[model samples]
Target: MTTAFTYSTTYLLDKSHYIETYEASVPADNSKKVYLIAILLALVGLAVLMLTEINAFVAWFIIALGGLEVFSIRFKKPWWLARQLISKAANTELTLTIDEHGISSKSIHVKSTLAWTDISKIEVTENGWLLYHNDSKNYLSSRALSDEAKAFLTTKTQLINALAI
Candidate 1:
């Protein structure tokens, strides 16, 4: 069976969708651990400054900078990266079709097909599916697919071991 759908993409939805899919597929880095270590190191430095009678302002400034660093690492960086990536793409309409043999997609600038063998990974995201090729990725929004189409694609696509991630 073949399943197909079409939808127009917008920057905000696409951006959030991509980020959600990416976070699902890729594991978070050790940056959080690194940030915690940095916080500890900064506190040690602040204590050293106090013991040495260094300027009181400088010691407090180090502690303040460490707090800001922790805040950014925890909250700001992920959104900033999503904005940077999403800004690179132009809004366009997309058509996608999935079948037992392969998948095909078309946007304003590109049309392409990948056989089941060509797909390296497939990940189901919160709002859609992510298809990974050797050098590229494609997103198919669940909102565009009917229940029957979604079932067909899920069953057929899952049969391909090469595509399972």
Candidate 2:
């Protein structure tokens, strides 16, 4: 006979979870590329000013603007985009159940279940797992789960050939 294992947990959403989830889900901005292009533009403008008779003021202005762009990219401050999004439904309660059958979840505004076969992908984040469906994703925080539950989830996701990252 085989024994079945099930795990359940309930927790309220918090700011840190929201920020971490957002960082995991969204790709980093391409600031490096932007900065590189800015440098090239500034160099070209300087060359034109020195080699040709182009207006010195315009050339210098372009160079200064490029420098500013680089500074902005390097020391850019973070906006409240993530905070605003999290605040809208802050402290929302969520419950998750994981069993041999699959995963079932309930939250303030949504309730759904995803079978192992139906899961498109599973991404193991630094502090949680991202369960991907066709058009949506659910984030399950590691803090809410026991160590055994985490191991079970990792094993099941691997058995189903789900991509883990």
**Per-residue alpha-carbon lDDT of candidate 1 for residues 113-148, written as tens digits (9 for 90 to 100):** 877687776667777777777887766667667786
For candidate 2, give the lDDT.
Answer: 0.77
Clashing pairs in 1: none
Q: What are the per-residue Cα lDDT tens digits for candidate 2 across 1-165?
A: 978998888877777766777777765686567578678879987987898898898889888888877776654334444454546457788788999888888897768888887777888888888878778887777888899999998997686553434
Report lDDT (Cα) of residue 140, candidate 1: 66
Question: In model 1, where do residues sit more than 4 Å from their true spots?
Answer: 1-34, 40-69, 76-86, 109-114, 132-139, 162-165
RMSD (Cα, Å) for all candidates, in order, is 5.9, 5.6
Q: How far out, in Å, is residue 122 in model 2?
A: 1.9
Q: Please report the candidate that would top TM-score against the real structure.
A: 2
